[model samples]
Structures are given as C-alpha cells and as structure tokens.
Target: MWVCPGEADPELVRAGVALIADERGSVLVDAGQSPSHAREIQAALLAAGLPAPRWLVYTHHHWDHVWGACAWPDVEIVGHASGADLLRAEADRPWSVRYLREEVLRNRRLGPSFRARALAVDSWEELRILPPTRVFTDEVELPTGVLLRHVGGRHAPDSTVVVVPDSEVMLLGDSWYPPPAHLRTPADEPDLALVGRLLDDTIGWYVSSHSAPMTLDDARRAIAG
Candidate 1:
C-alpha cells in the first residue's frame, strides 16, 4: 500500500490518497484536491515501482475528496450512489473564484474558510468536476481483497470505509469526523457502535483522513471519546 498524507490549512485543504496493489494492477483510495495533487501521487507511485492504478474509489463526495478525479481519466472511478448524485449536482454548477466567493457570502454551508481552500488552486478556471463513473449500494469487495463499506456519518451521509482484513487496516475517510462547523448541518453523533462492530480483533491499524494512522485501541478510544 502507498499513501500520500493529507494537508490541512487555512489556505488549502487536501485529503489523503492511497493505493492498494497486487499482482493484478492497483486500486486507489481518494483522489485528492486537484490535478497537480493527483499527479504528485502518480509520480510517487511511479518512483516506488508500484503498479499503475486501475480504479479510483471515493470514500465520500466532498470536494476535497473527489475534485481530483479529472486527473485520473484512465482509471475507473467508483463511489457510493448518493455520492455520485452529489458530484453530478456539483458538476452542473459553475466553479469560479467569483462564484465561490458569492456562495461563501450567500450560502451558509460554503463558508469563507472553504472559499479560501477552493481558491488555493493555481488556476480556478482549470478546475473540472468529475462524478464517479461507477457507484455501489451497501458494500463492494475489490479483487485485491479490499472491502468498501458505506458507514454514513455526520461529516457525509455517503461516507465509506475501506477494510483490508489481511493487513488488519481500515481507512476511515472522515467517516468519524464531526459535521463541519461551516455547514452547521444538524446531525446526530457519529455511529461509534457501527464503527466498533467493524473494528474487530482482526483490525489493528486505522487511518483517518486528516490524521496519521493510529493503533486500533487508540482509534477506538479517540472515536469513543
């Protein structure tokens, strides 16, 4: 597995992207925030002698997670059905500094902080939104023995988790995060019970979207706390 850690800042927001490979090509996790970011990941994979990815899977439909889909045109994109719908809706909307600034002012959900991150790109006009080409309901298991399961959360209703039972690792992809303060969207607490059920004795390493990977016990305590 190869991972490109995410970065969070007032001026930029980038979620992590990962690759799980086997003798039969590879499967990518998130797509990052822009074409440049995606290229960086690709270059790293090339340098590491990893197989080129055949599929890109989204953990959710958030901008920071799926905006980089434009860069991986050759790879098939997969995501939750609701996430695809959200991305399709976003694809229909205009993306520009002026538009984003206006939305930041008018749309409470798109706050000023988000605007800053969105405008951090070198060229806003070059930004292109691509929804997932393939979507699934419930869960799907990749040939790599990776499991993608929907575990809706306040952060994103279409949130998904990737489980590698053999490796005993799971990518949480912000599924355990609280709803963004910008959105102020009313939501229930995170479903720690469901998360708990998934984190059986087999799983040891847990990766959250923004933070470094943590031990299974640490993950459980963090989620419960």
Candidate 2:
C-alpha cells in the first residue's frame, strides 16, 4: 500500500494505492493524483526491492486515480472500456492549465499542503491524460492473481474494482462511497448488492479509494445499515 505521510486532511478524501506483484512483475492499482505522486509510488517500489510496475489497473476514471498514468508511458494500463471513453472525452474538453489552477484554488477541502503538492505542475502541457491500453467489460485476469472487475454505480459509470485473490484484497474505487454533488449526475444511483458482494468473505481486506483499509466485518457492518 502507498501512504503519503502528512498528506491526510479530513476535508479531502485520500485514496490509498496498492501494489500487487509476483515473480513476473508488479501491477499498480491506482496511478495517483499527479506526476509527483507517481514518482513517490515509484520510489516506494524501489525501496521495497520491486521493479517498476508493468501494469496499471485503474478502479475508475477519477483524476486522483488516473492523472499519474502519464508518468508511466510504457506501463500497460487496464480498466473498464467506458473508462477509456471517459478519458478520451475529458481530453477533448477544455481542461487547460488556467482552468485546473482555478479549480485548485476553488476547492476549499484541499488543504494548503495538499494543494501545494498536488498542483505543483510547471506547465499545462505537463498534465497527461491517458486512456487504458486494455479495456474489459466484466473481468480480466493477469499473470498474478490480479483481477479487474467492472462494477459501475453512482460514483461513475466506469467504476471498477481490483481483486487480488491471492492477497484476499479488493480495491474499491468509490464504488461504495458517494461522489461529490458537482461530480454526480442524475443517472447515478447506489448499487447495494454490489457492495454486499464486494464485502463478502471472498475479500478479506477492503481498500476504499477515500478512506482507511477496512476488514470484511467492518465493510459488512458499514453496509448493513
């Protein structure tokens, strides 16, 4: 798991990134918020004696979970088919550097420290928006026990979950958590059954995109209500 020390602020949701590996190579669950965040992840991998990630599996199309993908030009990225479409659509929109700067300034939830670190971009050109190299509608298995499953919900139409069967861990990217009002659309709605299935005994650890890791029981209780 990748932890950014001194970066947590209650107002903001700090997503946790996970690394899955076997003899073949490493696979990153999320790319992080910026190129700097990707570098931090790279440093963590090096320190752990692991090689650079060969695969990057995104849980969704959120900027926090995908913007860092530009840093790994060679990594084979995988996500839901719709995620690729969304990325393409977003790239076509007016996401200029000035617009992003204004967004950073307007977000009060981002503490000064987080704003400083996440938006340390030198130029708008530095921002990289990449679509998935590989896309799947339901599930796909990699060399390791890694599995990517699409479980769209209110969070986003392209929401996905990464399951590492060997590790008994499931990475839920906003699948259960509600998206912010501005980000939500009229078509979005919760999928309680998906939450229950994800929390089932098959997954021992639940890694949420915006909260601390939760045990199976914790997830069960959280969804019970």
The numbered model that scores best in TM-score is 1
Q: What is the lDDT of residue 149 in candidate 2?
A: 84
Off by over 4 Å in 2: 1-7, 10-14, 101-122, 184-193
For all predicted structures, in order, the TM-scores are: 0.90, 0.83
lDDT of 2 at 88: 93
What lDDT tens digits, residue by residue, belong to model 1 across residues 72-94?
86888889999888898988988
lDDT of 1: 0.81
What's the true lDDT of residue 65 in model 1? 86
* Every candidate's lDDT: 0.81, 0.74
Could you tell me the TM-score of candidate 2?
Answer: 0.83
Worst 10 residues of 1 by lDDT: 183-192
Predicted structure 2: lDDT: 0.74
lDDT of 2 by residue, 106-199 (tens): 8754344344434544455677788899999998998876888888876778889888777888888778766645555667565556789766
